[model samples]
Target chain A: MIKGGFAGRILHVNLSEQRTWTEPVDDALARDYVGGLGICIKLASDLIPRGVEPLSPESVFVLGVGPLVGTDLPSSSRMYAVARLPASGTVGWCGAGGYTFGAQLKYAGYDHIIVSGMADKPVYINIEDARVDIRDAGAMWGLGIDDTCESVYRDLDAQAGVIAIGQAGENKSAIAMAFVDRISTLGRGGFGAVMGAKNLKAIVVQGSGGITVSDRKRFNKLSRSLLNSFREYKYLKEWQELGMLKAFPMVPIDVYKRMKERRTACVSCPVGCKEVVRIPDGPFAGLVKHTSSALNLFTPMMYGMQDPWEAVKLITDLDSYGMDMFEFFGLMGMARELAGSGVISLTPEEPEIDLTSFSSMSAWAERIARRQGTGDLLADGFSAVLEKLGNEAKQHAPALIKGIHPYAGPGAALPWDRFGTMELGQVLDPRGPHVGSGGSPTYFAIRPLEVFPKHLKRMGIPENVVDRILGPDRNKLHVGRLLRYSHAWFAMLGSLGICARGQVNRFYNADLCAKAYEAATGIPTSTDDLRKRVDRVWTTFRELNIREGLDASKEALPDQWFRESGFKEYLTGEPLSKKQAEEMKKEYFDEWGWEG
Target chain B: MKYEITYIQENCSGCLRCQLACSRAYARSFQPSAACIKIESRGAEYRIIFTKDCVECGFCADNCLFGALTKTPKEVTA
Candidate 1:
C-alpha cells in the first residue's frame, strides 16, 4: 500500500456514459510506473487500443501529477497530459507548470484523471473533491481560453484550477492546445483537438483536503534543505529578475524591463520563469499578457516582427484562439515561402500572407482557427500540406520531427548552430519537438568535456556506463549514449512532478531525489533503484509507442539542418555528416538495448 | 528581541510557497486553504492576507523567496 505523497485514487470519467468511477492506486502500479507522465503513459497504453484514431473517442486522455506535487517541494506543481496526438498520430505526453492545478488535483484525492469516450453535447468535467459532475458548457463552447477560464471562475471558485480550450479546439484544429488558467500551455501535439473531439471544453478542480507525507519530519528536513540551497543559489537574483530571458538573449534587456510587470512562479518555486507583461504604451497600450516565459512573448521578433507591442498582441490573440504558436508560425513561414515562390497561391478572395504584418498574421490566425478558405488546409498541419502540394513542397517545408513542426534545433524557430541532446531528442522522443532539455550538458550551451562526467553522475548515470558514454577518446563525449541517461533523468523528474528546467533541476541530484522520494512516499528507494524505475518507465513508454508502429528506422534529421552552413556538431565543432547522424541514432537505440 | 511579520504585496509572485509552508507547520500537511496566510489573486497582482489564527511563527516569512513576507526584530527605543 502507498503510505503517502499520493492522493491514492484514480478518477476515471467516461463521457459517453456520463459516469465516473474511482480506482485505488495499487503498490505495483506506483512502484513500476512511478507517477505523473510515467503513470499516464502506462494507463494510456493499457486503456487506449493500438489502432484507435487519435481524434476518436477511443483515444484516452490522462492527466496526472506526481507524489511530490502537493507537498512543499520546490517547483513541484507540474502536471502531464498523455494522449494519441492528432498532429503526429502518435501517443505523446506534454507537461504544463503553473500554480494550483496539479496541487489542487492531488488535494481532490486523485493522482490521475483519465477521460475516455465522447460526450453527447458540449460539456466540461467539474471536479470538487469527491463530487464530479459533467456540466453543460453551451455558453462557453465558442469562447477563447481566457473567457472560458473566467466563466469557470465565475461558476466555480475564483481559485479553482481550470484547464480550458478555445475556438480552435472547438473546431478541432490540429494545432489547437489547451491552456492552464491562461498562463501555461498543456498540449503541443493537439491534445486540445482530442478534447474537442470528445465535446469537452474545460476541466475545473477545487479541493479542500491536504497532502501528507509518510515521514513528515524527514520530508520537512529535506524540503527545508532544498529550499535553503535554492535561496543561497548565486544566480537566484538574476534568474528572478530576468527569468528565461537571462538564458536566451532574444529580447532587448531595456525592452524586457519596460514591459515586464511582475515575475510569476509556479507553486513552491523560487525560480519564477513565468512572467506577466504589460504593454506600457503604444498601439497596444494597457495590454496585459501572462506568458510561461518572456521567450514565448518575444518569439515574433525572431521572425522579423519588429514591434514588441505588435508581438504581444499577436501572441495574445494566438493564445486566445488556443493555437500552438510554434506550429502557427511554422505553417505560416512555410506557406509564405511557398506563396512567394508561386508554388502555392492564395485564393483571390483570401488575404495576402505576410508574417511580418500583424494584421495579416492576425487574420491568418482567425482564418486557421475557424478553418476558413486557405486556413482549412493549414489547420491540418504539414502532412496535409505535403499531401496536397506534393514532393516539391517538401523541400520548402519546415523541419518537422514526428510529423509536427520543431520549435528547437537547427532550422527551427529557436535555431541553434550546434547539435545537442535536445536536438537529438527532437527526433528520438516519441513526442515531437519539445524543449524538455533533460538536464543535458549541451541543452543550450556548449560546455567543456571535463564537465560531462560530473553532470552525467548528477543525472544518475551509473559509473559502469560512464566510461562507455565518454568513449575511448577522452577528448570527445558520445552524445547518443549520454542521451539515454538524459531521457531517464527527464522521465524521473517528470514522474516526480519536479520542474526539469535548468534553473530548478540543476540543484537536484539523483541521491537527493531518492532521499526525498523515500521521505515523502515511505518507499525504500535507493539512487540505483530510482534510476532503474525511471529507466523502466522510459522503456515501457518507448515499447508502447513502438507497438503503435512508431518505427525508429523512419526517424531522421531534416535535410534543412545539414543545408545550414553554420550548423556543426556541438562536441566535435565539425559539420556532422548524414552517416554520423545515423550512427548516433543507432548508438542511442543500442544503449537502450533495442535493435537498431 | 521579538520579531514581527511584515508583508510586501508587490513582491509576492503568487507562488503560494508561504501558504504551503504555513500549512505544513500548523497541520503537518500541505494545503493552501488550511494555512493562516492566503494569497488572493486580484487580476495581475496578489494580495497576501493573514488569517486570525496566525501566530506569526515566521515560517511563512522565511519560506518567501521574493521578500513578500519578512520577519524583522522590533525596534527598541532608547
Candidate 2:
C-alpha cells in the first residue's frame, strides 16, 4: 500500500441518478497505473463501453491528479481529463495547469473524480471537502466561462477552484473547450461538448484538507534544493519578465512591454510563465485578458491580424465562447476556401468570410458558438462538414488526422522544415495534434545529433533501446524509435503531475523524478522501475486507443508535407519521401510491439 | 536579535509556494489554509497576510523566489 501523497479515495458522481459514492484507491491499481493520466486511462478504458458515443450518457469522464500534486513540488499543479472526445471519437487525455484545481481536488479527499450519466437539467458539482452536491446551475447555463466562474465564486468562495464551459460547449460545438479558473484551458478535443451533453455547467471545489508526504524531511530538502537552483539560475529574472516571449519572440517587445501587467505561476511553481495583459491604448483600451502563455497572444498574427489590440479582442471573444482557437481557425480557413471555389455557399444571413476583418471573424465566432444558420454545420468540425459537402469540398480541406487539424508540419500553422518528436507525435498520438513535446530533444528547436545520446540517457532510455534508436551506424537517429521513449518520458511526467513544458522539465531528469516520487509516496522506486512503470502506462494508453480502432492504418503524415519542398529529416537533413515516412511509422509500431 | 518577515505584496506572483512551505513545516502537510502565510487574490493582484500562529521561522520567506517575502533582523529601538 502507498504510504502518502494520494488522497486515498476516488469520488464517483452519476448525474443521471444524482448520486455520489467514494471508493478507496486500490493499492494494486495505484502501483501499476501510477496517477494523473495513467490512472485516468485505466479507469476510462475499463468503464467506458466499447463503441460508446462520445456524447452519450454512457460515456465516462475522469479527472485525475497525481500523487505529487498538492505537495510543495514545483509545477505540480497539472490535472488530466480523460474522456471519449467528440472531436476525434477516441478516448483521449487533455491536461491543464494552474493553481487550486488539481491541488484542491486532492485536498478535497479525491485523487480522481469519475463523472458519468447525463442530468435532466443544467447542474454543477459543488465539492466542499467531504460534502459533494449536485447544485442547480440553471442561471449559469448560457453564461460564458468567465461569468460562470464568477457566479460560482460569488455563491461559494473566490478561492474555490472552478471548471466551467461557455456557450460553445452548451451548444455542443465540436471545437468547444472548458476553462480552469477561466485561465488554463482543460480540454482540446471537444471534451466540453461531452460535459454539455451531460448538462454539467461547472465544478466548484473548496478543499480544506491538506496533502501529506510520507518522507517530509526528504521531500522538503529536495524542494529546497530545486528552488535554490532556480534562485541561482541566470535567466530567472528575464524569464519571469518575458515568459515564453523570450524564447519564441512571437510578440513584439514594444507591444509586450506596453501591455504586460504581470506574470502568474501555477501552484508551487517559481517560473511564472502565464501572463496577464491589459490593453494600454487602443480601440479596446483597458481590456484585460489572462492567457496561459504569451504564445497564445500571438495566435492572431498568423491570420494577418496585425494590431495587437484587435488580436487580443478577437482572442477574448473566442475564449469567452469557449472555442478551440486552433480548430476554429482551421475550420474557418477551409470554409472560406470552399466558398471561394463554389463547393459551398454562405447564406445571405451568414457573415462574410473575411480573415483580416475583426468584426467579420468575431461574428463568425458568435454564430459558431451559438450554432446559428451556417454555423450549425461548421460547428460539427471538418470531417462532418466535409462529409456533408461531398468529395469536391473534401479536396480543399487541410491536412488532418483523426478528423482534427494538424497544428504543425509543412503548409500548417507552425510550418517546419524537419521532422521532430512532436511532428511524429501529432500523427501517432490518438488525441490528434497537440503541443505536448514529452521533453524530446527535437521539440521546437534543432539540436546537434552528437548530444542526442546524453539527452536520451537523461530520459532514462535503456542502453539497448538507445542503441536501437541510434541504429547500427551509431550515428543516425531514428525519430520513430526515439518517439517511443519520449512517450514513456511524457507518461512519467504526466503521471507525476509535473509540468512537461521545456522550461520546467529541463530542471528534471528521470533519476530526480524517481527520487521525488519515492520521497513523496515512500514507495521505493529506482530509475529503471519508474521507467518500466511509465512504459506500461504508455502502452496501456496505446492499447486503449487500439481498442477504439486507432492503429497503424489510422496514422498518416499530411500528404501536403511531402508535396511541399524543403522539408527534411531532423538528423540526416535529407529530403523527406513518402516511403521514408511509412518506414518511420513502421519503426514506431514495431518499437511498441504492435507490428503485424 | 529578533527576526521578522518582510512582505512585498507586489512582488508575489501568487504561486503559493510560501504557504505550502509554511504549512508543510508547521502542520506536517501541504495545505494553504493551514499555513501561517496567506495569499489573497484580488483580481490580478495579491495580498499576503500572516496569521498569529506564525513563529517567524522564515520557511515561507526562504521559499519565496519573487522577493515577496524575506526574513530580516528586527529594527533596534532607542
Candidate 3:
C-alpha cells in the first residue's frame, strides 16, 4: 500500500490494439514527480518518442489527479491533462476545474490514465472501478460538446463525470478544447485535437469508493481549520455568485448582476465561482447559460459587440463548438487587419469579413467549426494559416509568441496588470503563451504595496530574503525573485491538484498545501521541499522540450509586436524597448539557472 | 445545552467540506455519503438535508466554510 491520498493504480488503454490494463504505480515515481501536471509531463517525456508527428498513434495523452484530489481541501478538484500537443508541438499541459472529473477518476481507483495508439473508428472510454470498457462512439461523432456530454451521461450514470470534445475536435482543429462537465475546460495546448486524432470522443467516470488518509484525525483537523479560515475570507460571497467575473475590473458589475440567475459551482468547491445566467428580454431572451469565461466575454467585444449579453452568446456558441477563444480572436484579428490592408482577399463564401459585427463573427465562428471556405484555412490555428497563405500572407499573421496566441499579451482584450514577470512567465511557459502560467502576480498588481511583505511571508518566503528583495533601493514592482518563486509555486499547485484561481485561492500558499499533504499522506514535507520538487519537475520538462528540438533562444514575443508598434509598457507608461526586453529575458533566465 | 443544527441552503457552495468533516468525526473515513448532513443539488440550487442519525455534534457547523450551516440552542417549551 502506498501510504495515503493515492489510488496506487494507473490505467493504460491502447486504442490501436483495443486492449486495457492497469499498472501498479511506483512509489518512487509518485514521490519524485509529485502528481497531476508533474507526473503527466514526466510520463509523456518518458513514453512518447520524438521525431513522430504529435497526432500519431505513438504520441501519448496523460490525465492525472494528485493526492489532494477527492479531499475537502479548498480547490482540490483540479486536474491536469498533458500531451506532446499539436498546438505548439511542445510537451504542454493544461489544468482543468469546475467539476469532480479528477475526484471521480481518483475514486475510481486511478492516479492517472494514459491513452495510447489510435482507434480505427470513433470510440469512448468508460471506467467504473476495476471495470474499463472501450465502447463505439459512432453515433456521438460530430456532435456538439453539450450534446456529447448529455448523450454519454444519459446512457451511463446521470452522476457520471465527463470530458468530451465537440465538432472542433472531430474536425481536428488545433484550437479545440476538452470540455469537462460542459462548464469547465482543459483549455489550450490542443489536447482535444489529439483525442480526435485517436478517434476518442469522451471519457465517462463514476465511483463510490472512499479515500482513506494516513492520519485521519490530523487531516480532518487541518481541513476543518482551512474551512473556518474561508468563512472569514471577505470576498467569499461575491466570488460565490460571480466567479472570476468579479475579478475583471473592466466589466461593469451591474451588467453581470442583471444577467446572473443562479450560481452553479464545480464539484467540492466552496467558493462557487461559476454562474448560470438568464437573459431577461431581448433578441436573445430567456437564454440560460453556465458557460462564459473572461476570454469568452471579451472575444466578442473585440468584434465590436457593446453588449455583454451578446458576448455571452458568442462565448456560449463557441463553447458548444468546443473552440479556444484565444486562438479564435487571434485568427479574426489577423484576418481583419490583413484584409483591410489589401494584403489578402477573403472569398465570398467566408462570412462577410466585417471584424466588428457580432453577426459576422458568429457566422464566421460557425464556418470555422464546420471548416467551410476561408474558415477552413483559419480553423487550424495561426501558424497553419500563415503557412497556407504563403510569404506575402505571412506579413499579415498575428504576433503569436511560439506559434500560440497569448492569453495575457497585447493580443487579448482584458487589461492585465502585471509586475513585468507575467510577460516572462508567458514567454517561458512550455505551452507557447498563457496568462495563468506565471503565478499569482495579478493580486500584487491590484493590491497595495505595503502588504507585499505580508503576502510574501504568507507564501512561505523567508523574512531575510523578503527584506533583501524589498529593500529601500529596490522598486516595489521589481519581481525577479518573485517570478522565480511564482513558477515553482504554480508548478507545485498543479502537482497537488490545487486550483490557483486568484479569487478562490487568494490566501493560499505552499506552506498550507504542504501541511495538508503531510497530514493526509504522511509524507512529512515542507514549503522548501515542495519548491525544490517543483524545480526538478520544471528542469525535467525543459529537458524534454530540448530533446524534441524546441529552440529556447527563439522563445519570445515577435519583434513586430514590440518594434513595429509604439506600445507603452503596462507599468512604466513608456514605450517598451527591445534592448530592455532582452535584458529582462537574460535576468529571468539567470534567476531560473537556465542558459540564455 | 440542547441545540439544533440549522441548514441555510442558500449559503452552501456545494464544496462539501462540512460533510467531509462530519464523516471524519462520525465514520472515521472521508466519505460524504456517510456524513449525517447531506447536500443535494436541486437543479442549480443546493439543499442541505439533516439525517435522523445526526447526533448534533456541531462538527459540520464548525466547518461550514460559507456559513451555510449554523448550530443554535433548541428553545425550551414555555
Candidate 4:
C-alpha cells in the first residue's frame, strides 16, 4: 500500500549471534499503533519470553525510529527505544533527537531496529548502509560516554549513530542508560544494565540515501504551516534558546537553587530549554552543561543542599561513570541520614554532617562512582544498603519513590480519593494515565467515574468549572472520542516519524510539519491523517506496555503522591495536595477504558 | 578544514547528536558507533574536546546552543 511517510523496514540485530536482518513493516501496524511505543512493544512481544531475567543474555533490546523525523519539522528528529528494564522489571525506554535519527535510518532503507540476546565478547555493532560489523570495543569499556564515542569514531571509516553506556551500564548496575550523541539519553528503569549484561557495548547505524513519500504537494503545504506556527509560538522561542531543559530551576524549586540560566533544546530542536552552568569553586569547579540533568537532578539537589553547579557536576560525574543519578542521590539520602544520625562518621577528607564544602561534595561524588570506602555502599545501590541498614533505612526507603530517595519530600503530586484507586488503575491496566500532558481527558476517561465528593475533593482547582473536569457523562464523557482523536494524532505522527512534541509541540502548527515531511520526502499528507499517525504511535506504545505488563491494576500515583509532602511548591507556598489527583486518576482511567 | 567547538569535556553530557549527525550526513544511517565527529573527555583537565577529521561542515557550530561549537562563515550552508 502507498504511504505518506515511514521507511517501511524494521532492522533486527542479534548481538549474541552477531547477525542482522531486515523485515518489511506492515502498513496495518503503522495505522494502528504509530511508531515508537506501538512498534517497539509489538516487536518486543514476539521475542520476550515470559519471566526473562532483565540483565541476562536473553533480554531484548529495542529501538524505534518514526517517519516524521528529520524534514526540518520542529522537534521532529527523534527516535524511541524500549525493552525490559534490568533493574525495575518494568518497561524501559528513552527518546532522542538528532539529525541522523529517522532520516539516516530511513536512508538506510529501514524504519526501525531491534537487537536481542547478548554478545559473548566486548563488541560494538556497526550498521552502514547494507554493511554491518561487530567490531571489538575492548578499549572502550570503563570509559565515560564521551570517551567511548571518541574511540569509536577514531576506529570507524564511516560516521554512525552511536548509543553507548558508560561504566555504570557495563557494571549492569540496573540504572544506567544508553547515551545518545553525548547530549541526550534513553535513561529510565535501568535497562542500561541489560545492555551491559549482554556485553554489547554500543550500537551504531548510518545510512545515506533518500526516502520517498506518498505525496509531496500536501506535505509541503503542511510543513510550511507548521514552521510558521513554530516561529510564532512563544514556547518555540524558549525551546530554540533553551532546548528541552526549560524551567530547569523551577523543577527543583522545592529543593535546589543553582540553575544559572535556562537554555535551549537539543540539536535540531528549536525549543531551547537546556541550560549550561559552571561551578564557581569546588572539586567540580569549572564548566558543565546538561539538558534534563541540570533541570531534573542538579536543580533539585542545589536547592536541597544549597549548592547548584556543584550538585549538577556531581550528577554529571555519576553519569560519566554510568551511575544512576536517581540511585546516586537516593543513596546519598541514606548516607546523609546515616551521618546526621551518627551511624557513620566522616572518614578523613570525607564530609561530616556539618560540612558545607562543595569540593568535599565533589570528591564524594567521585568516591561514589569509584566505589571507594563507604561509597561502595552507595554503589551497591539503595535497595541493598537499605536492607543492610535495617530498620532506619527501611523506614526511610518508603519515603523514596519506587525505592528512590525522594527529593521533593513526602507527598508528591497525587490525589487522595483518587490515589490508590486511580494510579492502581494504571498499574492494573498498563497504558498508564496517558499523562505527560499536564492533564488529558483520555486519562479522565480511564479513571473511576467522578463522584461529587471525590470530584470536589480532587478537582481542588479553584478556577476550573467542576463539570468541565468531571465531564458531563458522570462516567463516559467523550473519553472515547478524545482517545480516538489522540489515536489519529499519534498515528499520523508515527507514520511520519514526528516525535518532537516536548520541545516544540507548542510552537509548530500542523501545516509546517506536513510541509517539512513533504519537502524532504515528497510525501503528501493532511492534518487529519497526520493526527491518526500520532495516535497510532501512542496506542502502539500503550499496547506494548500492556503486553509487557501494562494494565489497569498496575498504574497508580506513587503512595507519596497522596500524602502531603513536607515541602511546598517552590514559587508558590501553597501546598500541593493529592486529593485532586486521586479523584482525577479514576475519571482518567474510566475514560480510557481502564476498570479496576 | 577544522571545526571549532565550545564543548568542555564535562559539558559533553555524552548525548552524541553531533556524532549521529556527522555519521548520517557523511555516511547516512543514524549510527554514532562510527561517526567522524568524536568527543574525547579529559578527566584531569575537566574537558570534552570534540575531535574529528574536519569535514568543515557548520552543522555542529550552527546547532550549538552554548557557543560550544562556533561555526566559521565558510562552513555555513546557504
Each candidate's number of clashing pairs is 0, 0, 1, 169
For model 1, the stretches where C-alpha displacement exceeds 4 angstroms are A341-343, B74-78
Alpha-carbon deviation at A263 in model 1, angstroms: 1.0
Model 3 stretches astray by more than 4 angstroms: A156-158, A292-295, A341-344, A417-419, A442-448, A460-472, A476-481, A560-571, B1-12, B36-58, B66-71, B75-78
Q: Tens-digit lDDT track for model 2 on A160-241?
A: 8888999999989989998888888888889889999999999988888999988888888887888788888898898888
Candidate 2 docking: what grade? medium
TM-score of chain B of each: 0.88, 0.88, 0.85, 0.57
Candidate 2: residue pairs that collide? none
lDDT of 3 by residue, A1-596 (tens): 35788877899999999999999878777777777778888888888888667788888888898888888776688888878777788888777883767877887888899999999999999988789999999999989888898687666522567899988887888888888877787858677788888999999887667678887778777776776677678878767666676666446667767777666556566777666677766789887776534435555675467877677778888888888887887788888877887766778766656656778888888888888887787778877877777777777776677678775545465435343556656777766777666764434454555667766666566777665446664344545556666677777878888787766566577788787777767776777877777788887887888888678554865665465333345355566776666666666667677886
For TM-score, candidate 2 versus 4, the one ahead is 2
- In the predicted model 1, the residue pairs found to clash are none
What are the per-residue Cα lDDT tens digits for candidate 4 across A61-111?
A: 677776665333445666766677744455544555543444556666677
- The 10-residue segment of model 4 chain A with minimum total lDDT is A413-422
Candidate 2 regions with alpha-carbon error over 4 angstroms: A471-474, A572-574, B75-78
Give fnat for candidate 3: 0.46
The model with the greater TM-score, 1 or 3, is 1
True contacts kept of each: 0.74, 0.80, 0.46, 0.02
Superposition error at A279 for model 2 (Å)? 1.0
Ranked by TM-score from best down, the candidates are: 1, 2, 3, 4
For each candidate in turn, the TM-score is 0.97, 0.97, 0.93, 0.70
* Stretches > 4 Å off in candidate 4: A2-4, A99-102, A155-159, A234-239, A242-268, A273-297, A300-303, A306-308, A338-392, A398-496, A499-503, A508-556, A564-580, B1-78
